[model samples]
Target: FALIHSRWTRRVTLLKRALSEIGIDPRRVHLEWISANEGAKFQRTVSWYVNEIKRLGPSPVAEVVDGQA
Candidate 1:
Protein backbone atom coordinates (compact mmCIF):
# COMPACT_ATOMS: atom_id res chain seq x y z
CA PHE A 1 0.00 0.00 0.00
CA ALA A 2 2.80 2.34 0.89
CA LEU A 3 4.58 1.74 -2.39
CA ILE A 4 1.37 2.33 -4.34
CA HIS A 5 0.62 5.46 -2.39
CA SER A 6 4.14 6.79 -2.86
CA ARG A 7 4.04 6.31 -6.62
CA TRP A 8 0.58 7.87 -6.84
CA THR A 9 1.70 10.83 -4.76
CA ARG A 10 4.60 11.48 -7.09
CA ARG A 11 2.36 11.19 -10.15
CA VAL A 12 -0.20 13.58 -8.72
CA THR A 13 2.49 16.07 -7.77
CA LEU A 14 3.83 16.10 -11.31
CA LEU A 15 0.33 16.34 -12.75
CA LYS A 16 -0.54 19.31 -10.55
CA ARG A 17 2.63 21.10 -11.57
CA ALA A 18 1.95 20.51 -15.24
CA LEU A 19 -1.63 21.73 -14.92
CA SER A 20 -0.47 24.89 -13.18
CA GLU A 21 2.03 25.59 -15.95
CA ILE A 22 -0.76 25.27 -18.49
CA GLY A 23 -2.97 27.83 -16.64
CA ILE A 24 -5.31 25.27 -15.16
CA ASP A 25 -6.22 25.43 -11.50
CA PRO A 26 -4.61 22.47 -9.74
CA ARG A 27 -7.40 22.48 -7.19
CA ARG A 28 -9.82 21.45 -9.91
CA VAL A 29 -7.97 18.19 -10.21
CA HIS A 30 -8.23 15.53 -7.57
CA LEU A 31 -6.52 12.23 -6.91
CA GLU A 32 -8.08 9.71 -4.61
CA TRP A 33 -6.97 6.20 -3.76
CA ILE A 34 -10.10 4.10 -3.81
CA SER A 35 -10.14 0.35 -3.89
CA ALA A 36 -12.81 -1.57 -5.76
CA ASN A 37 -14.37 -2.34 -2.42
CA GLU A 38 -14.83 1.32 -1.55
CA GLY A 39 -17.78 1.92 -3.80
CA ALA A 40 -19.53 4.21 -1.35
CA LYS A 41 -16.43 6.24 -0.73
CA PHE A 42 -15.85 6.56 -4.44
CA GLN A 43 -19.39 7.72 -5.01
CA ARG A 44 -19.15 10.24 -2.21
CA THR A 45 -15.84 11.57 -3.45
CA VAL A 46 -17.13 12.00 -6.98
CA SER A 47 -20.30 13.67 -5.81
CA TRP A 48 -18.37 16.09 -3.62
CA TYR A 49 -15.88 16.91 -6.32
CA VAL A 50 -18.63 17.55 -8.81
CA ASN A 51 -20.39 19.91 -6.42
CA GLU A 52 -17.17 21.73 -5.66
CA ILE A 53 -16.44 22.24 -9.31
CA LYS A 54 -19.97 23.47 -9.93
CA ARG A 55 -19.52 25.99 -7.16
CA LEU A 56 -16.36 27.23 -8.84
CA GLY A 57 -18.74 28.35 -11.64
CA PRO A 58 -16.83 27.34 -14.77
CA SER A 59 -13.35 26.57 -15.91
CA PRO A 60 -11.14 29.38 -17.13
CA VAL A 61 -10.53 27.31 -20.22
CA ALA A 62 -14.23 27.46 -20.95
CA GLU A 63 -14.20 31.22 -20.55
CA VAL A 64 -11.47 31.47 -23.14
CA VAL A 65 -13.43 29.22 -25.47
CA ASP A 66 -16.54 31.37 -25.08
CA GLY A 67 -14.50 34.51 -25.77
CA GLN A 68 -15.09 35.83 -22.28
CA ALA A 69 -11.57 35.40 -21.01
Candidate 2:
Protein backbone atom coordinates (compact mmCIF):
# COMPACT_ATOMS: atom_id res chain seq x y z
CA PHE A 1 0.00 0.00 0.00
CA ALA A 2 2.81 2.37 0.77
CA LEU A 3 4.46 1.66 -2.53
CA ILE A 4 1.22 2.24 -4.44
CA HIS A 5 0.58 5.47 -2.61
CA SER A 6 4.10 6.68 -3.34
CA ARG A 7 3.74 5.86 -7.01
CA TRP A 8 0.43 7.65 -7.28
CA THR A 9 1.79 10.69 -5.51
CA ARG A 10 4.72 10.87 -7.89
CA ARG A 11 2.42 10.38 -10.88
CA VAL A 12 0.12 13.15 -9.73
CA THR A 13 3.06 15.49 -9.29
CA LEU A 14 4.26 14.69 -12.78
CA LEU A 15 0.75 15.21 -14.12
CA LYS A 16 0.51 18.64 -12.53
CA ARG A 17 3.86 19.60 -14.00
CA ALA A 18 2.79 18.44 -17.44
CA LEU A 19 -0.44 20.36 -17.18
CA SER A 20 1.40 23.52 -16.23
CA GLU A 21 3.81 23.06 -19.09
CA ILE A 22 0.82 22.87 -21.46
CA GLY A 23 -0.64 26.12 -20.06
CA ILE A 24 -3.37 24.47 -17.98
CA ASP A 25 -4.10 25.34 -14.39
CA PRO A 26 -2.63 22.70 -12.10
CA ARG A 27 -5.44 23.26 -9.59
CA ARG A 28 -7.78 21.72 -12.12
CA VAL A 29 -6.31 18.34 -11.22
CA HIS A 30 -7.32 16.49 -8.08
CA LEU A 31 -6.35 13.28 -6.28
CA GLU A 32 -8.36 11.78 -3.46
CA TRP A 33 -8.30 8.55 -1.48
CA ILE A 34 -11.70 7.40 -0.28
CA SER A 35 -12.62 3.97 0.95
CA ALA A 36 -15.68 2.09 -0.30
CA ASN A 37 -17.64 2.87 2.86
CA GLU A 38 -17.09 6.59 2.58
CA GLY A 39 -19.96 7.43 0.29
CA ALA A 40 -20.68 10.76 1.92
CA LYS A 41 -17.06 11.73 1.77
CA PHE A 42 -16.95 10.83 -1.87
CA GLN A 43 -20.02 12.93 -2.55
CA ARG A 44 -18.57 15.87 -0.73
CA THR A 45 -15.28 15.56 -2.55
CA VAL A 46 -17.01 15.47 -5.90
CA SER A 47 -19.17 18.44 -5.00
CA TRP A 48 -16.19 20.44 -3.88
CA TYR A 49 -14.23 19.63 -6.97
CA VAL A 50 -17.19 20.54 -9.16
CA ASN A 51 -17.52 23.88 -7.46
CA GLU A 52 -13.79 24.48 -7.83
CA ILE A 53 -13.91 23.73 -11.52
CA LYS A 54 -16.81 26.11 -11.92
CA ARG A 55 -14.93 28.75 -10.01
CA LEU A 56 -11.90 28.27 -12.26
CA GLY A 57 -14.20 28.68 -15.27
CA PRO A 58 -13.55 27.08 -18.64
CA SER A 59 -10.11 25.69 -19.27
CA PRO A 60 -7.75 27.56 -21.59
CA VAL A 61 -6.80 24.28 -23.22
CA ALA A 62 -10.35 23.86 -24.45
CA GLU A 63 -10.19 27.20 -26.21
CA VAL A 64 -6.94 26.26 -27.92
CA VAL A 65 -8.40 22.96 -29.06
CA ASP A 66 -11.43 24.77 -30.43
CA GLY A 67 -9.09 27.12 -32.32
CA GLN A 68 -10.16 30.15 -30.34
CA ALA A 69 -6.75 30.65 -28.73
Candidate 3:
Protein backbone atom coordinates (compact mmCIF):
# COMPACT_ATOMS: atom_id res chain seq x y z
CA PHE A 1 0.00 0.00 0.00
CA ALA A 2 2.84 2.35 0.81
CA LEU A 3 4.53 1.70 -2.51
CA ILE A 4 1.29 2.14 -4.43
CA HIS A 5 0.55 5.40 -2.68
CA SER A 6 4.05 6.68 -3.34
CA ARG A 7 3.82 5.84 -7.04
CA TRP A 8 0.39 7.44 -7.36
CA THR A 9 1.56 10.59 -5.66
CA ARG A 10 4.47 10.86 -8.06
CA ARG A 11 2.22 10.28 -11.04
CA VAL A 12 -0.25 12.94 -9.90
CA THR A 13 2.57 15.40 -9.42
CA LEU A 14 3.76 14.76 -12.94
CA LEU A 15 0.22 15.15 -14.26
CA LYS A 16 -0.19 18.54 -12.56
CA ARG A 17 3.13 19.70 -14.00
CA ALA A 18 2.12 18.59 -17.47
CA LEU A 19 -1.22 20.38 -17.19
CA SER A 20 0.49 23.58 -16.13
CA GLU A 21 2.92 23.39 -19.04
CA ILE A 22 -0.04 23.14 -21.39
CA GLY A 23 -1.78 26.27 -19.97
CA ILE A 24 -4.31 24.35 -17.89
CA ASP A 25 -5.00 25.01 -14.23
CA PRO A 26 -3.45 22.33 -12.03
CA ARG A 27 -6.32 22.73 -9.59
CA ARG A 28 -8.53 21.24 -12.25
CA VAL A 29 -6.98 17.88 -11.47
CA HIS A 30 -8.15 15.87 -8.49
CA LEU A 31 -6.68 12.83 -6.80
CA GLU A 32 -8.64 10.86 -4.26
CA TRP A 33 -7.88 7.66 -2.41
CA ILE A 34 -11.43 6.61 -1.73
CA SER A 35 -12.24 2.94 -1.42
CA ALA A 36 -14.98 1.24 -3.44
CA ASN A 37 -17.38 1.44 -0.53
CA GLU A 38 -17.17 5.22 -0.18
CA GLY A 39 -20.07 6.05 -2.44
CA ALA A 40 -21.16 9.12 -0.52
CA LYS A 41 -17.62 10.45 -0.37
CA PHE A 42 -17.19 9.87 -4.08
CA GLN A 43 -20.41 11.69 -4.87
CA ARG A 44 -19.44 14.65 -2.69
CA THR A 45 -15.99 14.83 -4.20
CA VAL A 46 -17.38 14.84 -7.70
CA SER A 47 -19.92 17.50 -6.80
CA TRP A 48 -17.23 19.69 -5.27
CA TYR A 49 -14.98 19.29 -8.26
CA VAL A 50 -17.80 20.15 -10.63
CA ASN A 51 -18.60 23.31 -8.72
CA GLU A 52 -14.93 24.26 -8.71
CA ILE A 53 -14.64 23.82 -12.44
CA LYS A 54 -17.73 25.92 -12.98
CA ARG A 55 -16.27 28.61 -10.76
CA LEU A 56 -13.04 28.50 -12.73
CA GLY A 57 -14.97 28.72 -16.01
CA PRO A 58 -13.44 27.29 -19.18
CA SER A 59 -9.85 26.15 -19.58
CA PRO A 60 -7.27 28.21 -21.43
CA VAL A 61 -6.73 25.25 -23.73
CA ALA A 62 -10.34 25.44 -24.83
CA GLU A 63 -10.01 29.13 -25.68
CA VAL A 64 -6.94 28.35 -27.74
CA VAL A 65 -8.78 25.65 -29.61
CA ASP A 66 -11.65 28.05 -30.32
CA GLY A 67 -9.13 30.70 -31.48
CA GLN A 68 -10.13 33.03 -28.69
CA ALA A 69 -6.84 32.83 -26.80
- CA-only RMSD, every prediction: 2.2, 0.9, 1.6
Error of 1 at 30 (Å): 0.4
- lDDT of all predictions, in order shown? 0.90, 0.95, 0.91
Q: Candidate 2: deviation at residue 27, Å? A: 0.5
- The alpha-carbon lDDT assigned to residue 54 of candidate 1 equals 90
TM value for model 3? 0.81
Q: Pick the candidate with the highest TM-score.
A: 2
lDDT of 1 by residue, 1-69 (tens): 899899999999999899899988888888888999999999999999999899877798988899997
Name every residue pair that clashes in candidate 1.
Answer: none
Tell me the tens digit of each residue's lDDT in model 3 across 1-69. 989999999999999999999778899988889899999999999999999999989888787889997
Q: Which ten contiguous residues of candidate 3 have the minimum total lDDT? A: 56-65
C-alpha lDDT of candidate 2 relative to the true structure: 0.95
Decide which is better by lDDT, 1 or 3: 3
> Which 10 consecutive residues of model 2 have the lowest summed lDDT?
1-10
